[model samples]
Each structure stands twice: as structure tokens, then as C-alpha cells.
Target chain A: MSNPSPALVRFQTQKSLAHRLTLATLTGRPVHISQIRPSSPTDPGLAPHEISFLRLLEAVTNGSHIEISYTGTTLVYRPGLITGSSPGSGASGGVIRHELPAGCTRGVSYFLVPLCLLAPFSKAPINVLFTGSGVITSATPTGDMSADSVRTAILPLYAQFGISNNIELRILRRSNVGAGGKGGAGEVHLVFGHQVRLPKTVHIMNPGRVKKIRGVAYCTGVSASNNARMIEEARGILNSMTGDTYIFSDVSSAAYLPSKDKSNPNQKRKTGVGFGLSLVAESSTGSLYSADLASPPAGGVPPEDIGRQCAYQLLESVSLGGAVSLAAATTVLTLMAMGSEDVGRLQLGRDVLGSETLICLARDLKAFGASGWGVRDANTGQEGDVVVSVVGRGVGNVGRKIA
Target chain B: MEKARRMHSTQKKYRISDFARLIYDESLAPAEVVRKWRGEDGMADLADDHGPEEAVEEDENFFRKAKHNDDDGNNNEDRLIPKYDYDTLAQKWSNPENLESLRQRFTTANLMKERNG
Candidate 1:
């Protein structure tokens, strides 16, 4: 808090902006990112969703400063303490209400996942209620997972880091993407009550056999039969592989959004009508792999297609054969890096390790002054599973350190 | 220590192989992972995969969950016990593709591939 004009970590491009910001927040560093969509001519600068995320960061944190250029092409951010819904910091009743403006195409997970990484380090319990027209709970074509997947697949992973208690991702109201993939009238509540001094250093080399499969088939503003059809098709494909499979059905009415027409501004219109599926396969050793698929807002594909494709996607994730799936790799690795000053090991599939996103994250960590990861081949039953050893930065929860 | 000492005094003999697990699959309880075929064009009935050894280590809850999959009684498609030919398994021991598929199937990949359909 005493440092003035801290050295800024310079980065280029809008790609992985959220993760870069997340790293900066965790490391208590300043960042200057330029050329955010500068190449695009028609509509340039930071996207709407990115701006929403920056606003969210400002809400959950205290004293964080952000400066965007006139064109929004260049930006500088000086991160502050993760206050997390404390009193007198724009939080009402221990809750930070973050609203997404209209024209946001990404799903709510785009915000929730990044916010989760920041929550554990916050000064107080983090409870954020996302209520807005732009919160698409369902998976979008943009590849963000459904809110259900974030709950079932991703949130449970915090337990491994000893940050498990009082964490809940409640989907108060569900909605799929509206027309033009712009918005959904959904309400989601995230409670991250546990703040730890340091995450437990872990060694997860064994990806045991997936023993059971649990999932949710949800339909909003559509016939409940859509859930049935999806479950049937998915179960049909997955049953023969392993008999222990159960998919729950959730049917909800469509979200009512205020009409945009100037003539009847008060009139409500039904929007974000769709169905989706989220499946999580849990291994005997507590490893989780998840898959999500939702019908497009344009609406033509049958529920069977979504179900079958999602089942295949789950199978594909399982086939990756690692202690961590690609979806959870970033979280697992980041937590490991923020852990105690010791080496933590995680076994990941070769493809998962070689993925561009993971590679970029490794480099970004290096830029943020974290130790390099040590990769060695795992001689386990599964072929090509590499064990990545990360030495922790030992700078976990700066607020917790002082308090 | 007491249990091992008492076991040592018994008439039964102990071996190192029994104490040492060769693989993670052998060490874990039988939760029944789906078999994935890795682009094998040949039809292989690799049912011994979840052989009698897994039957010994099977979780009762998992076994029960395996049995009661019927939302409706008409769903008789669940095979509680699958029948496999031990002869074919022995005959294919030397087959490279069978061994390769077995290795691939055990790990979590290429499950219920479209090749079968």
C-alpha cells in the first residue's frame, strides 16, 4: 500500500486479459496493457464483457485504480487489496451487487471463474449477487461453460486447496442467451466465505477411474420433455460405458425482460428461451472432468443432438487422462502457484499441457515474477501424463497476512 | 504392526507381489470406468477389462446404483452382469492391437467411439 508509481508489467493484446489481470491482482502488481483490439477497424477497443469484468474487479476490491485511454485501446491498472464485500466499500449487507450491461455475449462463467480466483485472497467473505439482463447462465457459443458446470465441476475443486467452507454458487434464476447472443435475464449468487492464509501444497498425480457420472439437464421456457430427451440420449450413450450415471432434470420458466420498444417501455417480454446440459464425471481419486452444451438461441437442433454431443464431449475429457482436466487446469495451477513456499505437483495430459492457453499462462506467471514450472513425464499407468511442479510464490492473501 | 505380526504367525504365506500394487487401477476401488477404443477398426470384445478382480473390489453403493438405473421398468437395457468369452481373451493375448486397445481403454480415452456404431 505504501508503494507509489510501482513498476508496471507491460503486456500486449486483449487475449487472456482476464487471466493477466487476475495474476496482477494476486501478485499485487501494476499492469499496463496496450493494443486491446486495436487492429479491428469497425468496432475497436476493449469489448463490453472486458469492461464489465474491470467494473467487477473495482467492486470486489479496495483502492484498485484503472485508467483506460480515450479509444479504450490502452489501459493501466494498479491493483489493490481484495476487500470482498466489506462494509462501506460499495457493498450493501455483505453483498457486492454486480450488474452486467446489455450487449454482453459471454456467459456468466466468464466473470464467475475469474472472480473465484480473487475471492480466496480477499479481506472479507466474498458474496456477490449477479443480477442483470446480460447474465447468460447457460453456455454460449463463445465457449463459456454454464453456471451449473461452474458449480458442479469447478467450485468443488477449492476443497483440494483447503478453501472449501461456505462456498456456494446458487443459480437463483436461469436463462439462456437471448436473441443476437447479447443478453439473458438471469440471477446468480456467488458466496466465497473461506479466506485462507495459504493454499495447501498438493501432489495430484493419480487420475483414478471415473466411478460415477452426475449431471443436470435444464430447460428454460421450454417443455420439460426437452430435459427428458436430453437425459435419455446422453444416458443412452454413457450407460454402456459405466452403469453409475444419473442426470437430474431442471425446468424453469423463461426470464421476463423489459421491452426495449419506445412505445411500451414498461411492457415485459419473454426472452432467453432455451435448454442445456452440464455433466461432471468424478473419478475415484476425486478428479473431476466436465462438459457443457446448450441449444443456440436461433433454435433448430434437437435436444438429442445436444445430449449426444455433450456425452461425447464428456467422454473426450475423460480420454484426456490426467489428474486435472483442461477446464480446471488454470485454477489448479494458479492455486498451486499461490500456495506455500514449496513445490506442488500436478499431473496433466500432454495435450492439456501443450494447449495454447496453458502455455500462455505459464509465460504470464513468469512475467509476474513467479518461479518457472518444472515438467517431467509421469511414469504412471496413463501414458503421456506430465507432472508439472510449481514452486509457490509464498505471497498468498496479502490481506490475511496483515489482519 | 500387530495385524501383520498375527498374520505372519498364521499358516498362510505372504508374498511381495500381494503387498505391491502394479498400477493405480489395481489399487483403486472398482467404480467402473467406460472402455474407450483408440481408433481401432477391428471389432474387439475386451470384456475381461473389468474382470473378476474388480468384482471383488466393487463398491456396494456403486453396484446398487448400477442395478437401479430404470426410471421406468421397461428399461431392461442395463446389463447387471456381462458375459464374455474367456477363450477369445486368451487367444488375443498376443494380438498387439488388443493389448494396445487394452492399454488405451484402461486410461480414460476414446470411450464408446463412433467406430463401434
Candidate 2:
């Protein structure tokens, strides 16, 4: 094409009053046009209602709308393209079932648009919803009623599934549809979502998963008086986890202090941030002692001292979200990036998530105790309910690398 | 004599901040993952103190005593020591001049030679 004159180029660059009006008509909303020359001094903009009507007409002509009902409440939603009704909807009671018969054209001009507007905002309880008919009968360039009707029919279903929107869906200049004579149809896409929080008193089949990883601070001491100091430190740490703190003693100290190596400092000095690392320095206290974190003792002492306390507890893990072993010692590197200090020494093998590899570790940590694992996929970004069952308690058996 | 004195001073200067970084850096992995792993209260601070600058020499001496000499399976000294501290491993790690000696400090060949000798 020959280079256009500068005046013509400037004219093309400038949006005319008619172009502005058309855009307002298409948008279905009042648009404040500014900074450009008003083509005609007498032409103030189209009336707000008229502009809305024009946009709605364009939407019906080029796009489409779909009203869906589920469990008594009806929802009118629009999609980006004309696909089809969402899965499982077309087969049974769906948007199509709820709509009026196709032949009813009495309100095609005025009432149809009103119905389209009402479908989305309707709060009617819907037990069995069906697709409403006559959602897409509109004027088109080709003027083929049959073609327009089919486009209108398929477009709403697509919109319900999040495919299309606007009854007058426009096909762009380079659209893929061949021989663009009244061939433009909008597509819709849809997805359903629900959210439910766990009950305060959850009925977990096993309590092992219920045990949150605990944070503890302990200073070992032999004498009773010194043992008390350890309790103070442990209690301080535990208090930070949650106000409701408790202490229990098992004949086997291993449950509390997994690495109580009296000889190796690496093992003996197992100052952990998990469940308190404690030893019964004396036998006076007993086997079980619990403390409500919210209500600590007057002297900031652990409410109950079960036995010769070697350490005190402040916090514990309620869930083993995830854990992973990373290459290049990245576990520590990542934690450093997250900001250190808040996380202390990980219980040599405590499970954690959001850092390192969270996908499988959280599930495997479940296997550490009596509970079975619910392994989600390894790709952290992927979503869906994919919990695989592990065979047994997770110690000896190499955990299946669940994706 | 000057070198020995300088060495003694260098040893004394080994603050907890230095050793804190090493242990704290290592602690970061677990600390970051388990939000509660590091105590919400300043525990994460200690975890980050693993850098060499945070090492407290005196603290290390005491921590070493506590780690190596807990009174025969029962050290009941209620003396509070920060959970993590660096030990005076018999290497020249604290001083750059001593790095040459430190380089040979942990070599397998040197270890074998020492054992043979």
C-alpha cells in the first residue's frame, strides 16, 4: 500500500465521534471520552441507556450468556468462548433444562435481554436446573436464522463451562474460523470450587497425624535445682508454640529425646526446636504433666512438672506438612533465605513444607508415626486431590517418590 | 613471642558471632521449613548466628566443656549457655596466616603420614 499522507495518518490515529460511540455501544457502559476533538459540536454522546442497549445487542449478536442451577441456587455466568455446557450438565438437569422452549419468540426483543440480565442474579433455589432456551437468537451479518440459532445454542453451554460470553461474539480479523461469513461464535469455560474448614474437633482415624511438631528448649542438669532451670528454658520455647502446653513422660525417654547421647556432644547436646528434649532427672514428679500455654504459672514455670525435668516443652507440630532432603545442602540454604532464627535445629528428621521439597516429605513424615501417608503430587504447582496410600509405617520402607 | 602473643589474642577474639553463623547457617534449613522449628522468639536469630563473625571464644570454651565434660553423664550446672557454640578444634581456622597450616590440618595423606610416623 502507498504511504498515506500525514493528514490521513493523523486522521486515522484520531478516534472519531462515531468510533467512540461504537465502542461505548459495544462496552454496554457509559464511557467518559476525553482529550480528542469532538467531531460534531452538536453530538454530545449517545444516551446512557441507549448505549447500554447497543452494547447488549452487540453482546447478544457476537457473544452469549448461560444460566446454571445447582442444589437450588441458580447462577448466570458468562464464558470467554463457545465450547459447550460444563461436563455432567448437558446429560442431566442442566442450564438447558431450566430455560424456556426454543420456539417462544414473544419476548425476543425486549424481554429476552431482561431475562438474560435476570439469570445471573437470580437467587431462586434450584433442585434440578435445566438449560434455558432462546438465549442466542440475534441479528447477524449473514442473516441466517438457522446458523445464528445453532451458534446461540452451543455458545451458552460453552460459557457455562467457562468458554464464551456475550451473545454477539465477534471473530477477530485473523480468527481461525474459515470463511468468516457469520462464523464468529464465543466460547465459555467453567470450573466449580468449594471450601470447607476442618471442624474444631476433627475425628482423625489416628492421632499420630494430629501431633504437631513441637518446639522445645532444654538445658540439661543433674540435680533437682538445676533440672528446674532446664524446665524454664523448655517452657519458654514451648510457650511460643501455643498457649496450651502439656508434658508427658514415657518409660522410654526416646520418645521425647531421640538423640540423648550422653557421650557424643553432637548427639547428647541435642538442643532441638521440636518437642522438648528432656530427661527425668529425678523420679519425684510422675509420668504425665500437662500445662495450658495460655495460662503459665505465676513464676513463668511450666504448670506441671512430671518428673526430674531435664527440659521443658513450649510447642509441638500438629501436622507433618512435608519434608525433603535436597542436594548441595540446600535445605539449610533455603531456610537461610526464608530468614533463620525463627526455625531452629530441625529434629534430625522432622518433616516440614514450603521449604526444600514439600510434596512428598509431608506425607512421609506422616508415615513416621502410626498414621498412613496422604501423598500429593511432587509438582508443587500442580493442583487436584491425589492422595496415594503408603503400604506401612514409613521407617524402613523407602517411601515411594510420590508425584 | 610476638607471633605467639598475636595468636593468643586472636584466639581470645573468637566471638560467639563467628561460631553462631556456622551452626545458625546449618540450622536455617530446618528453621525455614518448620516455622515453629526455630522458636518464634529470637531462636531464629541464634540459627542465623552460624556465621563465623558471631563466635564467642569464651562461650566456645565453656560450650566445649559442657559438650565434652558434662559431669560424668550428669552435668547439673544450671549455668545458662546459648544452645550453640564453636569449639576450638586444634586447627588454624581462626587466622588467615594460619590457613596454610589449617590446609594440612585435615588432609587424608597427612593423617596417614602422622599415623605411619
Candidate 3:
């Protein structure tokens, strides 16, 4: 292999750590991040989800190396080849089952989103089951969207790049946040059967008018009436705009997990007992805008507020006026940056471009030796839309290159 | 001392821009999500210069005032209810003139446009 020892990319703080690690894995570059919550008096290191994510990366890859400082404030990670679920490398029966500890506060989509970015370039098919107590399948107040939205909104974008076959995100069991917002006992299974050497370069500039709106209203361990109330309230606002609006309802019982009480060794308690709504609007040109809202863990607000607020959020996303919503710009742009050598063009709204996440992602891509993006005003019918042209690194699927 | 001063200056520089990231209000830093929309303040440059004629023409009489129907044998005559009811009454859009006022609205516009002519 050429360039055996590439220079390590240096970063600071825990901001956008997920994207940074994803970029490193995609480009096979090593990263050294410092000052991860250095000043938090009580908890000053990498959070629980971050550690679990590192373990997940190791499970899917062949030879990744992750080293943390003594206080856990600093980390040096050398990315390995994404072996996926091939035989003999920590995968049993062609599937890797990764468990999150009881203390994880993030929703499972927190891990699923970044891991999906790594799937297309893997050497083999990626199949992983995320289970255990910390797997909150619904969106939390932490801004990690629900798994339903991941299946509905985020996965469909891969089809534009031509990597959309046999991919599935099955929410085996639904769960919301448990008491005090710590964890939930949920289970999710993901299968990415399509592995590509290079994703097709895409030039998407048209954000057509949203023609149809679809949603999922789900409640666990709560009254089925909660789902109807959320659907009714959301539809009350959305139905007037788009005639082709339908919200499906899913009601399930809470997950029963074993309790840690020593006195009653056989104790079982129900966890993740709340309701949430995930709404998605699909444009005529296959663009998706999504909104997610769930009842808070403390449980005082009504389901109606969640529905109405989520409907307003969907309107806000549509009003952003771009080919990609703010929630999806990072994924689409990252895939564009890692595509074949030709430049791919994407039209983004002014607000999405000015967002801190996208700006930092562009900078990080340049730091990882990818070419700079060319930004110019798009002359599309929409106002204030800018076209970003990303020249790909042309380095994709090193495992395929070797094999 | 130098490190402390440098940290303070940098913090001041990036205070507002940092809030654009999608992070919940961690108990430590506590950034508030302001629900106060800019539309509530109206358009800044377009607020004072607008004429009153644009306001006078929005006669809420023609639209169907389909909010909170009352059974007290009274109706809001301000919204133009029609004289007679068809078998399939176009109760959808017509507010008649004879029905007495059922309730009063507290909006600023309601003060000027009283019950009926």
C-alpha cells in the first residue's frame, strides 16, 4: 500500500465528533482529537455513546486502532479497512450484534446515521443488530431523530447515489426514553447488502414542490389513543396543504427488561413508555424533509403539542428551500466528497449552508486532503439557494482495491 | 493569566455562532431555545411605513367564521350570515345579518368592528 503512514488529522473538542470519525474512516486517515469536554467538572471525558461508537467501529472494521488519554479527554484513532460482516473478524453468523450500556442517553439513530455512511464502501455486506437497554428507538430531546425517520428520510437519499438495494432498518421493538432520560430497552436491525466500489456522482439542483406527506405516529406502553391524537393533530395542520397526506399509527407494548435490584433477583420492569411522531414530506423530485418530536422523559406535555410542533418543524424545513434539508445535508455532502473524481453539484439553502455543522464539515474535508468546495449562487427558481460543487477524492473502497 | 484571557476572548467571539449546532440544553451551559419568532415582531423595515388602507379592507365578514359554534339561540351577526337557509344550507360561507351576537372577541380588530351595522 502506498503512503503507509499518513499524517494524523488533529482536532479539538467534542463538536461534530461523529462526522469527524466518519470522515476519517471513509478516507482511511487517522485522527487525533483533544479537549473532549475538558472543563466539565463532573463528567470530563468522552460520553458513553462515543465509547460505544468506537467499539462498533472496531466490530465492523478489520484493524482500527483507538487510544485515549488517561483522563479520556484526548483520543488518537487510526481507521482500518471497513471489513463489514465478513467471516472470522468479530462477526458471528454474518451478523454483528452490538450492545449499548444502560447509561447511554442518545437515541440509536445517533450511531445508525454515521454507520450508514460507512456501509457503501465496505468490503462485504454490513449487517448489525443494535440491542440492549440503552437503545432508545424514538427521538429524544437530544436532537437524535427516531429510527423510523432514519428508515423513512435518511436511507432514501442513498438511492440517488445508486447504492440502494437490500438496505433495511427494522425497528424490532419500539422504545422511548426511560426514567430520568437515561436509557430504553429497544432493538433494531440493519442490513446493507449492497457494497459498491464507487458511488455514482450526482448533480442535484432541483428541489421540486413537496407533493405528498407521510408520517408514522408510534406509542409504546401508552394508550393507543395517543397515536390517534398525534395523527389527528398533525394531520389537522398538514392536511390542508397537501391532499396526499397519510400518517400511519403503530402501537406496541413496552420492552420488559430485567431490573438490577438485588433483593428481587428475578425482577422485571417495563421500560420506554412514551409516544412520538415522525413526519416526512416527499417532494416531486424525491427530496425528503422530516420532523421528529417525542414526549419528554419526565412526562407532563400532551401528545397534541408534540404533533403540532412537529408539523410546524416540517414547515420550517420545507421553507428552508433546498435540495437537501438541514438534517440530511451532512450525509449527502459527505457522500459527494467521497465519490469518484468528478465534481458533484448540490443546491443548498442559505440557512443550511450557513449552519455550523456543514461549515465545519467542509473544513474537515479539506483537512482530510479532499479538495475544497466551490460555492456559487444557484439560479434556480428558489431564492437564496447556493450551489456547492465538491470534487471527489476518487479514493474509494480500499479493500476492493486490494482484493 | 494569558491562557485565561485568551479563552475569554475566544468565547466572546464565537458565542452566538456556536448555538447554531444541534445540541440540547445540557444542564451545564444551558442555552435557551427561543420560541419567539421574528414574525411576531413583524417585518422590521416594513412595520411603520405600511398604510392603514391595507388593514381596513380585510373585512372578516365574507370568510366563514367556523370557530366555536354556540347553541344559546344566538349567532355572530358580524360575520355575514345569509337571510334564508337552503335545505343544504350554504352555512359553510354565509353569515346572516339578523342573528344577535353570541360572543365578543378580544382581538385588537374586534374592538373597532363591533357586533353589527
User: Residue B43 error for model 3, in Å?
Assistant: 21
Question: Residue by residue across A107-163, what tens digits does model 2's lDDT show?
Answer: 121222222322221122112121122221222111111112222222232232122
List candidate 3 segments past 4 Å from native. Answer: B1-117
Candidate 2 is graded, for docking, as incorrect
TM-score ranking from best to worst?
A: 1, 3, 2
Model 1, span B1-117: residue lDDT tens? 343244225312211122112112222222222111110111112333455554444445344645663332212111101221323432443345544453343334465672474
The local distance difference test score of each candidate is 0.78, 0.24, 0.77
Sort all candidates by lDDT, best to worst.
1, 3, 2
Residue A325 of model 3 has an lDDT of: 90
For model 1 the TM-score comes to 0.79
lDDT per residue as tens, model 3, A225-312: 9999998988887765667889999999998888789899799999999999999988878889888888999999899878877776
TM-score of only chain B in every candidate structure: 0.20, 0.18, 0.15
lDDT of each residue in B4-76, candidate 2, tens digit only:
4444443223222322232223333332323322222223244355554434543454456456633432121
Please list all clashing residue pairs in model 3, or write none if there are none.
B80-B95, B81-B95, B81-B96, B82-B95, B82-B96
Residue B90 CA displacement from its true place in model 1, Å? 31
